[model samples]
Target: MNRLKLTLIRGLPGSGKSTLAKTLNAVHLEADMYFINKQGEYQFDPKELKKAHLWCQNQCKYYLSEGQNVVIANTFVKHWEMQAYRKLAKLFNAQFSIKVCTGNFQNSHNVDLLLINKMKKNWQP
Candidate 1:
């Protein structure tokens, strides 16, 4: 029997969440991917955050239904922010784990370290 796995990579911007997600051989999903425009550019919109997350969740469900391992990378700073994915894991009967990234790399988003630190301080498991 093939067992499914769901990995959530949580961290603030500039952390290594995305990098770690890429390292895993799973279906990678992230809310930030919604920001990629047809022009192949990242255009973030605060108003679309909910939609982005919803899309990510939908993709996770689709992949898990197909018995594929999934990895989600996002700034899930609060416990509630992770609940949806946790529920999905349970629904799909996938082995679930959360990886918190603490490394402060030069973020591709160019977010300031101060803001990243603030997010880290406020982060909840």
Candidate 2:
């Protein structure tokens, strides 16, 4: 039987979380993907942030249950933000890992510098 793996990639915006996830050969997922429109345009709605995260978590769970390696890249500024993914990994008996990306690159989502700074200020790491 193939072993399942769940990888959580955490970092600030532009920190290379997504870049690293792509190289891991897993089903790469991110909450921001929930904001993408059918046309492939990102239409982020601040009011739906919670829903977006839930969707991402649900997607991860689905893929893990199907015995696939899943990688989630998100700005998990606080440690608690990773709890749900950790629980999912436990439920699936998957080997889980948390990777923090510290590279400074251009943010694809265009998150404001001020907000990114605030997130950094409150980061648990």
Best by lDDT: 2
Cα lDDT computed for each candidate against the true fold = 0.92, 0.95
Model 1 spans > 4 angstroms off:
112-114
Encode model 1's per-residue lDDT on 3-57: one tens digit a residue. 8999999988978999999999999999989999999899888899999999999
Scanning candidate 1 in windows of ten residues, the lowest lDDT window is 104-113
Q: Model 1: which residue pairs collide? A: none
lDDT accuracy of residue 76 in candidate 1 = 94
- Clash number for each model: 0, 0
CA error at residue 95 for candidate 2, angstroms:
0.4
What are the TM-scores, per candidate, against the unseen true structure?
Answer: 0.93, 0.98
**Root-mean-square deviation of Cα positions for candidate 1 versus the true structure, in angstroms:** 1.3
Name the TM-score of candidate 2.
0.98
